[model samples]
Target: MTCDRLVCANCAAPVNEGRCPVCRASRERLQQQEGVLGALTPAALLVLLVALVAVAVLARSFAG
Candidate 1:
């Protein structure tokens, strides 16, 4: 899960703030697990999907 709204059990603060050692470690781990696609926000992915669908539909219509 994203750390922005995560409440740290150790510090009782947002994990994004890295308010404690646990928060910092968790944040680091989350960052390490993320790659190219993970970098895209939900909205960005949705837009990309819509664009792909549009391209597919247009291509199919032209082909037939």
Candidate 2:
């Protein structure tokens, strides 16, 4: 649901590029909604996700 993947109906361009006023506004709104955590790069997010999964697995094993 990132703005990079969003298509602008105003200019038929990606919202992340900010090609039009609408795109820029939309991008800004999305970034704000995401907050500090959403500012992270895709790679960082993936690493965090993997770490969380590993923790979940460990916790499950310990529980059993």
Winning candidate number (TM-score): 1
How many Å off is the CA of 38 in candidate 1? 2.1
What's every prediction's RMSD, in angstroms? 1.4, 4.1
Clash pairs, model 2 backbone: none
Residue-level lDDT tens digits of model 1 in 1-64: 5788889999899999997899999999998888778889999999999999999999999999
- Model 1 residue runs over 4 Å out of place are none
| Ten contiguous residues minimizing lDDT sum, candidate 2 | 31-40
TM-score of 1: 0.81
Q: All candidates' lDDT scores?
A: 0.92, 0.92
